[model samples]
Target: MTRPHTLLLAATLLSLAACNDAAPSTADAGSLAATITDAAAATDVVTPADAALAPDDVPAPERFSYVPMGCTHRVSAPVGSTSNFRDDRSTFGAAPDPHDVHVNWPADPSSTIAFLWRTDPGTRATVVQYGLSPTALDQTAVGSVGTAGLMGNQVTAHEVHVCGLRPDTTYHYRVGGEGHWSAVQRFKTGPAPGRTDYDVRFVVAGDSRDDVSRWRQLQERAMGGMNPPDFEIFTGDAVLVGFLQGQWQSWFEGARSAMSTVPFVMVHGNHEGLSVNYLMQFAQPQSGVSSQDELYFSLDYGPVHLVVLNDTPLRSDYEGDVLGTQLAWLRADLARARANRARVPFIIATHHKPAFASSSHSDEIDTQAVRRGWAPVYDEFGVDLVLNGHEHDFELSKEVDGQGREVSGRRGTRYVVTGGAGASLTTLGAGALQPWGAHFESAHHIVEVHATMTRLELTPRRLDGTVIEAGRISLTPRAP
Candidate 1:
């Protein structure tokens, strides 16, 4: 398997990695013996109510015509280590898991965090609780998941965010039916570096679907290993866009271990967010009223300034809006980043569709338009790099200047499309390279980005854990 493929598969393997009673090998693809778990955590001192069917409350599978989507984590312990994880083992005819659960840590990785999950259809009452110690869980919150009225609604979910956590700390939690609480799970908040100077590792990929593919299994095991990344980012085309809710829920359940603890951030792809379900499922920072579908926003992590925008802006033609509101906001946000320049030295832009992709449909987008509008802003604001996904292939663009020349001048913008995540590869015509595309491959893969004040490096890997493409850039915060 290639490197990106290996990394994608790691997610499934991580669940069993820690249980093998040995330090996980960064190279293994086989599953190890490990414990399994779920989510029923109420964002409170104690779970407000039990969503899972009590032992006596559960109906026999033969009684209902519904397919089973079992109960998840049960966070009923008193805010400490006293909780244990388990499963209600809900079963329907040939069903894996139902009732999609979505979660996030939006409170700036500080004292408070948030999460969302899907409950049994028509079941509104639920519970979640947490504390440093199992004996002191005095916090509590109340929320419901799914359509309480529909009989066959497969698109229901539960959402909640936890708060008041100590920085750089780990706390235990559980969620589920009151009688069958999930095994207590643990998660650590982001490290509180004194002044945003620290090193962090995150994994990148796109186009992974939950409908059971060989590539999906490979990617799952690759991403589920012991030394998992800080978080996972899906660039775009994650799946056929425009589907109703719950379509991507299993994708979330399949990678619960890594996602529950790690903040999984997603950028709107050409395939997602047409409906409120997608946006509501994944909570993004408030992008004040920008055409109701302000599918763009920005965030600050440590010293890095990340700008996420929607490249698929509304247009009657094939190209995106040239002077639309998105561009204006991009200009203003970037300008503000320059005002307090030194605090954020690394500025990156992430969108679903790429400005340049070497896949079969490379010519679909108009490059001159991007360069004409956004590239200049990147040049003016000292933007270090641009990240995107759309093509079902992996690419790492060389550092280049505004004119598409190799950049030896400054921390100019470089583009990369790491989308071999799990979808079938979209073959290119040949060794086709665009003006700014540096390295390109037609392998299923992911990207691991490591950045610091002095340098930015990217490693693009295929599903089998092979580093097909790699590149680096050097720079200081100021314009050269």
Candidate 2:
């Protein structure tokens, strides 16, 4: 007589076989189930070859399946959550118009992605259909909808969170509901945690306010080549005024091509301020802090640990110690990342104002405050790189410690101010290049970063493909 566990395994196999054209014999099912059991107990190690297989070539058991690693799927509150709303704008027989559709990672970049789009305030459907193939979007995920008070007008913003995706895989998806849908768009997920076999690529850009033409050109160049970046890191100042709906619309229209296919990791800039408009537009991972959830957070992609902070000073009317609370959170977050440095070797921090820059804004009050408060924290945690914007120029600093002393041999934090996406260029300030400044230039450019287990390379290039400067950081092992 067969055992109960064996019978259960056989039943599961038969159910799976139903999806295929043919089912195996009873004896064959028993043999296959025993083989699967032995394989499961053998080992869980994934080899380099396994990581290199194309999405279509992955083994059947693992294809389109979720790898459980204790991830919590959380969706952000819909628009109008913080502001007063008008009447519902939905009509009885109107076609859905999904515009400004974009994607971002609100959870683990490897296993989850958040999609946001806008429609008339009256539209109500909030759904996303996705799958590995464009023709076959068999899986569906429901989301929430809310209204946003854009200037004096109201628009409905739809946000959907899709989780349990395979790492380094390309997926096609569409958003809508009630039998109306948008065109299909494709995006690739980031590499899995502790996986060093794949190279991670991304673009760093910022300060594109008031220059829609230039912004479009920069994005076209960044996403034109055969090998585009996995995602983009926008250093903020995306619009001239954060609360103005027109500016936000223009900014998204300029980034439509790049944002449609790759996730954007955003840094809140001074221009955006603390407005409900900014909060309602983008969905980001919560920082677990009540007041500052999407305002500042951290995420891991490939072997790099990225921390985004809100270094801008609080509004005069707001209460509580925003900066102090963020500092405490930073210390704890960096400690956790440092403890796991053996797996993710690089710690990169990004904010709006620069801790080290030799440009027009270098001597401003906010920039100085950011330098005084945050530079030491970065040094204490052995952060490898710091990225910033708001200078409207390009500047890269030598390795510097918390005390404003230059430390050579890659032992200190290196800062780069890459705020040349579209805003008018500004020249370096008089006597701004200090001992720690390695390079400075006033040009429209973007920084392209390529990261592997043992090496990280950053190349800043102008719109015309001219190389502004290049730098590399070698991975150093740390003790647990």
lDDT of each structure? 0.52, 0.71
> What does the lDDT read for residue 99 in candidate 1?
37
Stretches of candidate 2 above 4 Å error? 1-73, 76-95, 150-153, 316-323, 470-480
For 188-211, candidate 1 gives per-residue lDDT tens digits of 676563356565566777766423
For each of the candidates, the C-alpha root-mean-square deviation to the true structure, in angstroms, is 14.3, 21.0
- Candidate 1 Cα RMSD after full superposition onto the native fold (Å): 14.3
lDDT of 2 by residue, 181-236 (tens): 78899999988888878888899999897788888888988899888999999998
- Score every model by TM-score: 0.70, 0.80
Clash statistics: count for each candidate: 85, 2
Candidate 1: where is the Cα deviation over 4 Å? Answer: 1-102, 133-137, 144-154, 210-226, 244-246, 290-294, 314-322, 365-371, 429-431, 469-480
Candidate 1: Cα lDDT at 305:
73
State the displacement of the C-alpha of residue 397, model 1, in Å, after optimal TM-score superposition.
1.2
